[model samples]
Target: MSNYKPIDAKREEFRKYLEHAGVMDALTKVLVSLYEETEKPEDALEYVRKHLGGITESSSNTDALRKELDESQAQVTELKAKLAKFETEAGNE
Candidate 1:
């Protein structure tokens, strides 16, 4: 019976952590939105996935990031080439 106190404290601490992290609020909002829906979605899990910000949205963002990465790489290569050219000219002088 005495051992139960530590377990209860640990559970409460975890609950507080989740609340501080905004997880509890996000969940409450998602649940409220789900409850408020008029025509219930057939696949509840999919609905939850969409409400929580779907993976598809992030995947779409990858395309733009990849383009930026490629452009940055090209810029780095151009700068390195210029640096090498300047160093070679300085050495000759």
Candidate 2:
């Protein structure tokens, strides 16, 4: 005895499409690589994005993000120093 709905049939068709397109094999390789990692990535989505190959965001975009992060960190450090100075001046008053 078995029960299968139209959704199940559609899902089966989609699976076949993926298999035909070699998506399943590509996915399997990425999963295996993830499983074999001695220290798993903090960002699994990024890891998968990298392993899936070629569909990456431009290096220029990543560079821009990195530059923004560095600038933000520098601002934080400057703010911390100013706060520390203010606290010291307040305490002395």
Quote the positional error of residue 23 for candidate 2 in Å. Answer: 0.4
Instruction: State TM-scores per candidate.
Output: 0.53, 0.50
lDDT of 2: 0.88
Please give, for residues 1-93, the per-residue lDDT of candidate 1 as tens digits: 455545588899999999998888887888889999999999988888777774236756877889999999999999999999999999999
Q: Which lDDT tens digits does candidate 2 get at residues 20-82? A: 999998898888899899999999989998878733466678889899999999999999999
What is the TM-score of candidate 1?
0.53
